[model samples]
Every structure is written in structure tokens, then in C-alpha cells.
Target chain A: MAKQFNQLAYTNLDDFVYGSCPNPVTTKSGMVIGGGMVYPEINFTLPGMDINDVTMPKAATIYSNIIEGVLKRAAELYAPGVLIEFETLPDFTEHPKYGIEVNRILLNGMKEASEKYGLKTAIRTTPNDLREFSRPPVMRSGKYWETMLELYEQCARDGSDFFSIESTGGKEIHDSALVKADIRLAIFALGILGCNDMEFLWKHLVDLSNANSCFAAGDSACGFANTAMVLAEKGFIPHVFAAVIRVAAVPRALVAFEQGAVGPSKDCAYEGPYLKAITGSPISMEGKTAAGAHLSPIGNIAAAVADTWSNESIQQVKLLSEMAPVVAMEQLIYDCRLMNAATLNGQQLMFRDLLVQSDSALDVQAYVLRPDVVMRISAELVKTQDNFLRTKLAAQLTVAELKKAIVEGKVKSDKRDMKWLDKMEKAIETIPDDPNEFYNEMKSVLDMDKFIPSEYGL
Target chain B: MATLNDVSQCVLDGDLDGIKVLVQALIDDGTDPIVIINDGLIAGMNIVAPLFKSGEMFVPEVMESADTMNEGMKLVKPLITDEDIPSKGKIIIGTVNGDLHDIGKNLLVMMMESRGYTVIDLGVDVKEEAFSAAVKEHKPNIVGMSSLLTTTMMKIESTIKQLVADGLRNQVKIIIGGAPVTQEFADDVGADGYSDDASTAVELCDRMMSDQSSSEALSA
Candidate 1:
């Protein structure tokens, strides 16, 4: 069961299918190895050099250091490949052409790391981070797309092992059919350039592709969830994730088992799955360390599947033991009792560290049950992004509804609090009982609202 | 007949060709250029603003309608005399220095223009000195700074300081906004106003200008 992928000389889909096996087997000579994108931090330049001043060749050391840190852990966990994305900090003003320099620096580092560790490397393009890097994506324009393809062609020539082509249709082209078409056209171009060993962002494309593409959709609580069964018919590569809402995780576990996609490449333990389900960060972070929370049951369920597939205990008793306290703390955070206690500083990271790393529920309860600790934790997470997004969305809804309620004479003058509750209850009545429909329609509305400034008359 | 409704619809639909044809027919029909602009083209754009703010309309479509407004403006501009032109106020706006995000500023500029204000758009990634220089030169009634990064948003304070240092702070109303900006941040930074979105920014501006006029009358 040793996986063999032609570096970048893929001709057909069967080559990819051979690599993306449906089941994991424990054989020293052959394993259906899992891989993922790594954001292991490194300067990518001389150790102390400014990020803007980073130049290639000398930068290979930084890449090697970063890739080495990420891969060593990945390998320790039995995962084989790692995806590298070019994150241009500051801006892409220098070598802004298709992020060529940035990718070269990463590729050089990957080549060094692969040789050093005997691991596979893939450049994930779906969550390109180009926007953060200060450049538009290929899908931004035909010319940009053509130019990006040429740059990738150069990367293939310059020794990129594999490419993960995920087309995230931006504001202008977000129709599902258009997203698929964009991915198809991109794959066609990459194929023409003789690129191989691919990961299509969506599993359905992998199911339909002639290029043995495996699914690399990030663990967006629902990545490839809609069609995991369809992909399981071909091979299960859909991400299995925990959801923020508890009830949603059950069907997810079933799909993961049905699809045989026990890959860490598409799993998020807590905030990752929750955020991805609501927002569209399919391949968010793979680890739960940063999120500082547990995935209710999906995390264990996913671990159990891995345990069964690999025939290893994959002990999470310690991880699970830490959860009860965090669960209680999360309830406190969710209810927002912490915000009224004090203004939090540094996002109260001390709480995340203490609560997430507790050896047992007893330790967490003893540590967190104190008033001082609760205040510290609450204020910090309130100011933090995870809470901010959820709170902001709720606030926006209430404000919009309040205006409507006032207009409709539903709320009488001066009884604001009661009127707000009345409006909120009325608003809840409008949403159907179906969770799936609510999530889908909410996602659509949010996507439209979030479209870039130009759409709003900019 | 080229009713204001037709003009409004053409602009809302982003029919540039139709606007050119219809606006010219209105010119021949002896329609007031001010009415053609205020009740027709601008009426279409005003509809676009709230729809866009509410997320019912998209940017590309809004740009089309804005472009129609511009086209109709070209047709109607010469017809209105200097005295016929009603000045709302002057505004200087830009995405603050080191920030490339300006979608909000662009929409605000379009909305301000339709409201009959002269806007000097400094464009994206404008440096603090550049903002100060624009203020010094343009002498606008309001200075609007935009940013999408918390890191770059610090530059908003610096830009404000630069304005004060340049002795231009008292000459203008300062308003700040972006994804990360809050009304609390506005007060913290000593800005006169802060709005979360573009449409609200226009209303803020109008209200601020009215306040300014009331103050001036009292001072007088």
C-alpha cells in the first residue's frame, strides 16, 4: 500500500485515485498516508531580517526550518504529506506577479525539508491567502488567471511535488455551477501544463475528474459533507469535523465513517468546525490547540475512526479529560457572564491556556470555578474574534428586526427590552424548523452581504 | 415623454446607453436638468445605496447604476447654471495610509457625489502626509478616513495627529470607519463621528454638516 505519485507529470485521474485510498491499513511498507497544509511560523528570510527584505536562496533556510517544524510533528502523528501556501505578509508589492517569489521561497524550503525528512509536499491553492498577500486571485480576471497558470507552470518546472487546486469563487462568481466551472477550467489548464498528483477542493469534482484527484476541502465542519457519500462511492476523501451546535455532529460522524475519510487534513476540533460551518474556511486549522476547545463528540468520533482504520488506540483520554472543564467554561463564555465582570486584556489568553491544557475536569473546575478566573476568562474571549463574530451577527439581526418591528407597530414606545425580545421571538418564528435549510439560506445571505466593496457601489 | 421614473429605472438597471438616450430626450422635452438629476438619475442611485447597504444589491450592479448616473450627469451638467447648482458641502475621503482596502470609501464617494457634494478621493494606501497635504490644499468641510486593518487603523490616529499638527484639524470634521472601527474607537481617537457602513456614513455626514451650519449661525 505504498503510495506512488508522479511528481507533476499526471496524465489521468487513476494516478490520483491510487494515492487517495479509501481505507487506512497498518503495513510498514504501504500506508494510506494523510497530509495537510501547515502554517508553521518562520521568517522565510535571515532569522532577524525584516519580512519585506526577504530574498530567495538565503530564504531556503527559513523555509526548511518552518517546513521541518510542521512536518516533524505531522510525521510523528503518522501523516506523510504537508501542503504549503505562500503567505505574503505586509504586501505583494515585490514580485507581485502571481506570487512567484513567495512560492519559490516556500518551494525551495519544501524541497529542502522533503529531502531532509523523506516526506511528501503539496502546494494548496484553494485557500491561496493571496488576498492577505495583497494580490487578487486568478479568478479575479481572465488575464490574472492566465498569468497565475503560467506561474504555477514555472513552479511545476521548479519542482512542486503536487498542487491542490481549490477554486473559491469570489463575489463576482459565486454560483455553485460557476465555482465548479472555474475549478474545471483551472484543472484543465494545470493538466495542460502537465501538473499531477492533485487535490480538488470539492470532492464531487474529484468524483467526476479524469485526473485521479483526491479531496482537499478543508475541515469546514461541512467540507464535502453534502456529497461525501457520492465521493465514498469513488473513494472517501471528505473532511469529518465537529460542529459548534451539538446535534449537527452526529450525521457528520456517520458520513466520515461511511466515506472512510479519517484524514487529519479535514478535521477541526472546535472553533474550526464551528466557524467553517458558518463561514467557509473548509481547511481551517487542523489542530484544536489554538481553538482551546473540544468538538463535543465528533472529535472523539473522528479519532475512533482513525483508531479503527490504523488499528491503534490513538489515546484521547487525556484530551477528553481536559474537555469537561472546558465545556463548563464554554457554557460560561456562551452565556457571556464573563463580559460583565471586567474588561479583558490580551483576549484573556491565560484562560485558554489554563482551561484547554487542564489534565482533568477536576483541575479545570477548581481553577475556573473561582470568580476571579471567570472574570478574567470572560472579558478576554468577549473581545476576541470568535465571540465577536457571533455576537456581531446576532446584534445586526436584532437591530434590523427592531427597526422592522417598530415600523410594523409591533413594539410600543419606550419598552425597548421587552420589544426587543418580542421582535427576536417573532424573527425566530420566521425561520423554518429545518436546520439544514436555515444554514444554507443564512450562508447565502451572508455571502451576498460580504461581497467586496465594488458590488456595494464602491 | 422621458418621465423621471424612466430616468430612475435606467439608472437603477445600469443602462448607460439607455440613460444617454433618455436623458437627451428629456433635454429636448424641456425637463429641468435639476429634476432630471435629483428626481431621476440620483433617485435611481439613492435606491441602490440602501439596497446595497442592506445587501439586497451587489457591487458590480451598483457600479453600473453609478456609471449610469455619471453618464446622465454628463448630459445634464451643461444645462444647469452656476447659480442653479446647489452645493451640499465638500468632503475629503480615502483609505488611510498603508491600507489597500477602499471599497467602502468608493461607495461613500459615489453616494456623496449624488448628494451634490464635491468629493476629493485620495484613493487607497494614502500616507498620512498625503492626507494632510490634501486637507491643506482641498480645505474640505469633512475628512473621512477608512481602513480595514487594526494594524493600519492605528494610522488613522496618526493621520488625525498629522492634521492637527498641520493646523487643519479645526477646519474639518473627522470621521473614521471600516470593519474594525467602532463609535467607541471614534471617541477614543477624538474623531467627530464613526459609521459602520457607507450609507450610514452619508447620513452621518449630512447630520454633521447640519450641525456645523447651526454652530456657524450661532457664532455669527
Candidate 2:
């Protein structure tokens, strides 16, 4: 089944400059083979050789050592065909005197390491307005693009197999639109540079292309999932790309990656599915742990699909490889999506559904539909939400009624009717009869003031 | 006799052009620059600060208003001169080691500068020794360290530890901030203050300085 799926979905993998395998590789222990890339430690030092400052040399040396260590680790742990990515430190342009030199030294060191270790590298250039690294002649308008291209050329010259270009510096310049344009421009610019070692360059270019194209949508979560599905559909699922997919399915993978439990690239794709599953739901161990565990299954499926189709459609595999890094780099895209979904759903549950009870009977229907909100509201009402609601609704009700509700704990309801009262009575019987505790817990969940019209000018 | 209410309303409406015109008219009519700034501009900023904290405005809008306030300050700064520059207090601020991002730090600098404090900006990726040097050289009332990345935030602890080792920890209160930085982290590092945004940084500085003065007075 996996082989057949690969044959149908990935006919273009063979045309890639790199080889592809659609089927999963199984080891002697019967475990599937998967791979990922880890981001190196943040190098804070300015990169340069001629800077007279004592810190410059130390920074350069530290950066170089980090790259060397990463390369050595990658070689020791993975097979030669396995892909590893090293994200070059962003240039610090605020301190121009040493910033330019520091970036140069860092890039030069990275290039040397790539050559020696046969590693792939990606460079995120300083935003163009920043005083770091002189603007290249080709980039009179998009100066940052030219600077990044120069770094790509250097990487190419130094035997780097891949390059990922991202625009993340310059306060005025690094908007979402500009970032997308920059990535597209970098792709065309790199293509025009006439250095066509297709396998290496295409893989990196595909990653940026996926990231840029998806980010253009302006919804981080949707963009993340959309990018992963798009890349997978396109057969750009390299080992590192697969890692990104895994991260999309599991967000804790990010914490794990940061903690060095899993390689950075390994969990790249896990965040999306993990977030989608948990959106608007109680953060059950089922969602968090189950979503995390699901990565292994998807990873296996993706690997099987890749391995079986490796020989038949190298071109498609190559395309997949090219586009996969974007999945890895933008795991936060899924996180943003989950947050937006949660906020939207929570609003709907609270405002449009929860308050519209038909009778004195508590309408468990809405609560049933949104059990997470029910639990959240139940817990919050006992703590903070009731006070807020009480204060907000106090003006609408009779002062006598309001005081009785506060003191004697029996209040008439106009909105919920008699059915709600019966339901409340039944609910009270099943739980602690302490209305104050229940009201406080409910209060803890709802900030009724946020829903109310403000007293001041709009 | 214009109250803070009128000035605050003017700021909320983003009537910078009107503010400038009104301020210039006040100056022309012989109103003191310090009084106009304190009663009008600073009063206006105090309102804007809470708005910013509440997410009523984002970074760009805050920065734009800060820029407007800066222009107004430029007109007033020259009028005051060296002798007239009131000493609210001195602060040394920088992004901690291994973090180059400084948009928050820069905003805090501009906001602090507007509030009449002497600010020594140590710049990004600042080392512990450099911070120690600045503290020793300037003898500032407070030292502020910022880190935007979780990885770089670890440096703040070492920097504070270094300050303690150098015997300068007790001399200057420490304040920490940035995107990833938390008050819990600040407490862990023994920092005297933590602010999530630039306006809050100014408020914290004001409170910290006043507290220091009161403590000194009690000791004396």
C-alpha cells in the first residue's frame, strides 16, 4: 500500500538533483528510520577578523566551534544521505563598527565547516538597512537580498549543498509581505547566479518557497498546516522535511528540541496536528500525549511513502526535499493557528451559545457540545467569573433581587426561565451545595467586563 | 491652568500637530518648558502607557507617538541646557549576552529618555563585564538587562552574579525585561524590577528611584 501510494503521489522524485525513497526504511529492530536537523546555539558575538575589540575574536571563535561541533555530531549520528541543516546566526547591524566584520567571519567560518563536513547550510541575512555587511551592487533596491545571495554564493563555493534565505532583520523592512517577496526574490536570484547543483540548492529553495508562499496567507496556523500539506502533496518530504511535519503534529516537540531530547528538525512537522487536535478541546492528556504519539505513525507512513517511491520519481522527491525546510523552520505557525482557533471557539461558546437557556432546566446541550468550555467555566465560576458577571448584571436586575442572590442565594432568572432553575437545582444536588463556590469558580472563567460596553469613549 | 484631563485627551486623539501648536503657543505665552512637559506631555504619556499595557495600541503606533514625543522633547531639551537638565535619576540599560534583538530595548530607551532620566544604552549582546564597567563608571541608580530569546535569558543570571561578585550589586538596583523575560525570572535573578513594556519600564524606574531616595533618607 505504501509503495503504491508513493508510486502514484511522487512521480517527480527522480528528477530531483538528489535521490529519493518513498518507502520507509526498516532497521534490524523493525523500527522505521527517520531524520531531523537541530539548530545550533545562538552565537551572540559580532562576526569579523579585523575588529580590534576583544569580544569580536571570542565571538567568532565560539561561532566556529559551535558549527564544527554540530557538523561533527551530524556526521556521527546520521547516514551520509541523511539531510542536516545549520541556521547561520543573524547579523547584528545595530553596532555597525563590529557588526559587519562579525557577520563576515561567521559566514566564512560556516562555509569552511560545511566544506569540511559535507553539511547543508542556510543563511538568514540582516535586514538591508542595518549597517552590517556592505550592500551588494546587484541589490540597489532590495539590498538585503543581494547580501543573502552573496552568502549563498559563498556557501556554494564552500561545498554547501543547500541554502535557505529568510528576511528577519530591519524593523521597518521585515514585514510579512516583504519577507515573502524576499524569499521569492532570493530563489530567482540564486537561480540566476548560474550555480546549478540542483539537488542541494533545490531542496533548500523548496523550503523557503513553502514558508514564503504559506506565510503570505497571514494566518500562522493555517499557513503552517497548509504548507505541510502542500509540501507533502508535492512530495517534498525529505527526512528533515518529515521532521517538520512531525513537529506540526506535536508542539511539545519544540520544548523537546530546545531541551536537546530530539533534534530540532525532527519535530518540525509535529506542531500542526497536535494543535489542530487540541483546539477548542480540554487539554486532556489524550490530546497532548496522543497527538505526540501520533507523530511516530505519520512519520512511519511518510517514510514508507518516501522509500517505496525513491527510485520511480526522484524529481517529485527532489521537489519535496526542496520544500520541506519551511515546515521545519516555522513550527510556530501551527501554534499561532491553535491559539486563534481556541480564541474564536471559546468566544462562540461563551457568547452565542452558553447563555441562551430555554427553561429553568439547565441546558446541558450547549455544555455537551463544548465540554471543555463547561469544565473551564465550571472551574472558573467557582473562582473569578461569578463576581464579574454579578457586578455586570447587577444593573439590569432589581437591587432587591441582586442582594437576595448575593445574600440568600435564590435569584429569579428571566433569560434561562424555570427550566434552568430545575437544572441548577439538580446540578447543585450532584455537587457541593455551596453556591458561592460555584459562582466564584464560574467567575474565574468569564471576564464579563470584557463583554460589557465600556463607560469611557469608544 | 489646563488640567491633565485636557492634555491626556489631546494625546489619545493623536493630535500631535495640535499638541505641537498648543505647546508652542504656551511657550510663546511664557509658560515654562518643564511645566508644559510635565503637566502636558508627561501627563499625556501616562495615559498612553496604560493603554499600551492593555493592548489598545501595538508597537508601531506606540513607536510613532514616542517619535512625536521625542520631537517635542528636542524642542524642550535645548531650552533646558546642561544646568537645567533635572536629575530624576540615572539608568544603565542593555540587551543581555547572546541576544541581538533590541526593538523593545530601544523603545524603553526612548521612553526613559523622555521621562527625564539619564540613560546609558550599552547596546545588544552586552557582556557581564561591560555592564559591570558601565555601573562602575556611571554609578547609576539602576541597571536594566533585557533578553528577547529564551536561550539568551540565561545570561541575566550570570550578569547579576558577576555584579554581586564585583561588590556593585548592592550599589545599583537591577531591572530586567524583554519578550521572553518574566517577573518570576527576574525574581530568580534577584532583579529589583520587571516590566513587560517600555512605559512600564519608566513607571518602574520612577518607583525604584523614589524608593531608593527614601531609603537613603532613612539611613541618613
lDDT of 1 by residue, A105-221 (tens): 666655665666765555532222232122222323344344444554454445443333322223122222111212211111121111111121223222322133333223222
- Judging by TM-score against the true structure, name the best candidate: 1
- The weakest ten consecutive residues by lDDT in model 1 chain B span B52-61
Per-residue lDDT of model 2, residues B128-201, tens digit only: 99999999999999999998655467789889999999999999989999755788878887999998867778
lDDT per residue (tens digit) for residues B87-170 in model 1: 579999999866766546776887788666889998777889999999989889999999875546778988999999988999
lDDT of each: 0.44, 0.40
lDDT of 1: 0.44
Q: In angstroms, give how far residue B147 of model 1 lies from its true place.
A: 1.5
lDDT of 2 by residue, A159-274 (tens): 33323222211112212111121221111111111111111222333344233321000001112322333322222221222222222212221121111111112122223112
Error of model 1, residue A403, in angstroms: 34
Residue range with the least summed lDDT across 10 consecutive positions in model 2 chain A:
A307-316
Worst 10 residues of 1 chain A by lDDT: A307-316
